[model samples]
Target chain A: MRSFIKLASVALAGLFSAQSWALNIFACEPEWGSLAKELAPEATIYSATTAYQDPHYIEARPSLVAKARKADMLVCTGAEMEVGWLPVLLRQAGNPRIQADQPGHLMAAEQVERLEVLQKVTRSMGDVHAGGNPHVHLDPHRLLQIAEVLRDRLMVVDAENSHHYRQRFVDFAARWALAIEQWEQQAAPLKGLQYVAYHKNFSYFAEWLGLQRLATLEPKPGVPPSAKHVQKLHNLLEGQSVLAVLTTAAQPTKNAERLARKLNSPAVVLPFSPGAEGAEDLYSLFQISIDRLLAAR
Target chain B: MKNISVWMAASAAVAFSSVADAQNRGRISSTEFNPAISLILDAGLAIYDNDEDYEIAGFPLGGEAGVAEEGFAINEIELVGSADVDDKFYGKITLGIHQDEGETELDIEEAFFQTTALPHGFTVKGGKFFSELGYLNVHHKHAWDFADAPLVYRALLGRQFNDTGLQARWIAPTETFLEVGAEWARGDAFPTGGSPQDGRGSAVLFAHIGGDIGASNSWQLGVSHLQADDVVTELGGHSHGGGDAPDNEFLGDVTISGVDFVYKWAPNGNAKQRNLKIQAEYFVREMDGEFEFEDAANAESGDGNIVADQTGWYVQAVYQFVPRWRVGLRYDQLDSDNQFSNVSFTGFGSADDLIEESGWADEDVKPARSTIMFDYSNSEFSRLRLQYSTEDSRHPGEEKDQQIFLQYVYSLGSHGAHRF
Candidate 1:
């Protein structure tokens, strides 16, 4: 009878461990959610903000709090990209597993070398991120580095699935590398293509393709464009050979179109993040963005 | 000596390289783990046709409930600081500065610490903080859609209910949103003065449930109740005495219950361009107590039992039709009923006069007001607003006051995220 009782206890423990094997991931944005899915396809993923929404400002909704409460891992593009709401949501979640410095907490931006890092920051900078630009995902090389960090973190948090995670990472990395090579070849024509954008959202993308940014519609980061600022930008780029006026799906297209009309160029709406139109995954997101730029040319 | 020199050169090389690396990384030399500090400045110019003393017909105002001063005035300047105290707790303090009657007044609006590492979706908060009794009470004044508190809040909650308190809240693990919380306060503020019941004066329970309606809409509904024992109010108490005048005091138990609802909509869940928010709250208060009167000049004293019931409500909607621009409309109404019993007086004036002075007698007129406002925000840090309101609550049928206000609010330094 004693042996039977011990066996029953062992069986119960196995059941509990099996239930915990499937990770619950809470991502601050759809891009991270998509990347996490690639690394751990078996994990359940929930994205707090969709591609159509701005990641900088979002409401700390109760549903998000509930998700954070149950998450086994929290993945986000940190560097104050989610400074507005993630802190509040973390405090409200009350889950120590995903707090800062915990193994389950992963900030993708911190793992990469950022661009546009400021020497001095003040409110007059118009919402500039002191840690640098948080839109590092647009650069596929930095994204690969972030993925390596994410895989290592996932293995540390869920050691039992380390082998499975490693295998998935290897396959994903190979495929991603091949895709990047093809994209670079296809986007070679975009090199030195002068363009205008609504915001500084495409800084990494432009850098990756060697695109020249003539000016932005917004005078400063996070500040809406005024007629005077637009007029100034138009004057600055009036005689230059501008490729196109660019905007993201999340930003208002009116200003971009107005500027495009003034410049006599096509207004291209790029899928800035995953889950946007024609950009259902990381691979498609870049493909669609490049296709849109080339189409404008 | 040669070895020492070689070691010093190696150390110098390492230090110089590290400094260069730091500069390449753009690390701020002045960066420190300091608490974030923000200051909000609010100033406004107001014009009112009727400048008589502002008062709700059946509600005695207390705390910071009053009309905005006429002409240009500094409305409120608030300094706020917040930080994570450590791994386990977060703390925040807010100091409010304003001008009152040609004098500057300072108030510690909120100081609180909340636990961050509690399990089972439970959080405990201690210190002086605003009571989460209603939807709008927890939000600071600068976050309000309108320039002033709603008439219901002014009449029933004395503008807002904030005091020294401890709170505990739990979020249920549901598909939708469900939250339950309770508070225990010292209750030394208005609506419950004197810190009765052995200094544990007030207790409150609140529950909220919310969910998103598709991708573009969200809504929240809440219910709350507050009970306070031994609330004391000085009705006509004064040191100077007049013939046939009585010094009256009220002592009683008070209970207030409220329900609030809020609905918000933004196109495709993006609020940067356009959004609409509609919110409403209704509150009912009941006071059961006795009025103790002392007629010092007539050398007589008497006691009377009084029961009062009051209700107030306001509904407002603000629509952001374009980026950085918004328009709003609000309506407020209030009602009260009072019953007096077992009063015998001699040479201390009539009971009618005492009841009227208490501001509890029903005058068969419901106080109401209508307001409209338009605001423009250059950015998230600065806002300018123009408001117009018609109020009949102060005099209630005597004359309605047409009021206009132009206000500006600006924030400097680091500001925390606003809660939904």
Candidate 2:
């Protein structure tokens, strides 16, 4: 009986070592963090920022830098979406493995097509990206493409578990295809609906659902709307029947509330990304966002 | 004529290949190799109750302390360019334009190249750059909360000191943030005057450790030491508290040691809307050498072997209750002590009387200043500030100087985010 107990102890030790040896993954946003969780459930994961914060701007805190330093791979929505802070974090982290041009650095936007590509970029246009719109994760079809690319990246960075990662990708892709059909059917009523948005964050979602963006509350991207701009928006809304004024959970509600009150329309706040406001995963994120839009009507 | 034709043909071939290359890329972009450029402009108006000339007693002044001449002035226009030189290095250049004595002058504030990819988390930088000795020296004038610099900084290091140097830093592989750096610089500035060749003038060693306290607070602590040879203190032209002029010289080795601490609180780790920061630093300087005084009227000289120790410190706190508004308060103080031996007077006066008249006979002079500032930022690129101060920075005997300032700072183009 003593010999049998000794054998059991050795097996438990092996199991714990395998768990400890899992790769460390650092995701810049919650969307990528949820995807990494699905792809590599056994690996340790850290999400740098939550959904309720603007990913465009952030402080490179020391805790985040520590995560970046020890990470085997870095995943981000990089089309200059995080132009304000990511470069400084990467530089300060001083981690060569996840630097640009390396396989460990995977940018989801690079795997899919982009919209609003500007021919002449200028600051007067108010913070328009040179690499086009970076909020492509909302498009289910594009997310699948990004998932495939990320799966391949994980294989390249952690080849010891390439077989396990590949199988997970296959399962995730098959389930994601079925879910896209369901979401499209559910969101059929949103087509041709006109609405106002706080910013261009909902461009991909609107494009996928066939919704018409009549006007923006913000004067420009990343710029707050002045009183004159808001007044102009109110005048436009008076002439047309609008669905609602849409804002994200990450944004403050004061401007949208003012617009909604003037227009007598319902104000809708949707979860812009995963891991916030009951949108804990990719599937639930779309469900919650579509349901909120429908409920506003 | 034959050789000229041959050269022309070669040039024509070179131009043809370049055009072909451009066509192959399928674009006509002129800024492909251009670096990131930015410009910062600072303009301010100062109102002073007493316009008498002012200087910190027992300290040498070499930086901008004139405070805009008590009227509307164009403080500075700073232009910066930065880029990655290659996969392994980065380069930055800054030019500052200011009005001095009714003439506009341009100065290169910083020009440096730093390595990005080095083994063992090591990085090296070389060129003319601000010494990362204190909390505020690395930050520019536009980034300051108040319109004017702190009294301690103006007295201890002449507002800010930048030198041509080489620095090497290493980040330890640990959970916390730990960085250790050393610099070898040309000590041709105030507080440290020596040769620029072979790095014999000045050397510095510094270390900083930082970490987070849960999700709401973060803190950092730093200590530094700087040593230089053949230091000279020149304070002839600067008048302190309505005092007469005396040509004074201090000679010997100078050493300065400093300690700094910073603590920041941001509720739920979201600093965008609200936050509070407290920062403080203490500096002590020692000069072991001789003091020489010259009477300009009689051409008489007095000499004494003296050792001087000077200390200064400042504490400041800033709070942002809303996204676009902030308020800050700062207090600073300076103290000095001089011990004299082997005193000799070659002038037509007694040694004690000469020392007393020259402002070195006293044990030490302590002066302090307090300031309050409020600023409104419409965006990250621009800010307007109002500041008021009650200061007795020149001498302990003089009454405090009441001052007010209104300033504006604006930035245009691509400006990179600063480190915390």
Per DockQ, the best of the predicted structures is 1
Q: Kindly report, for each predicted structure in the order presented, the TM-score of its chain A compared with the true chain A.
A: 0.93, 0.94
Interface RMSD of each: 10.9, 12.6
Worst 10 residues of 2 chain A by lDDT: A94-103
What docking tier does model 1 reach?
acceptable
Comparing only chain B with the true structure, the TM-scores of all models are 0.87, 0.86
What CAPRI grade goes to candidate 2? Answer: incorrect
Q: Write the per-residue lDDT of candidate 2 for residues A193-240, one digit (tens) a residue.
A: 999999888888889999999988878787777778888899877868
True contacts kept of 1: 0.36
lDDT of 1 at B398: 68
Tens digits of per-residue lDDT for model 1, A56-121: 868887678878888888999887888888988988887777877465778777666788888778
Error of 2 at A18 (Å): 4.0
True contacts kept of 2: 0.17
> All candidates' lDDT scores?
0.82, 0.78
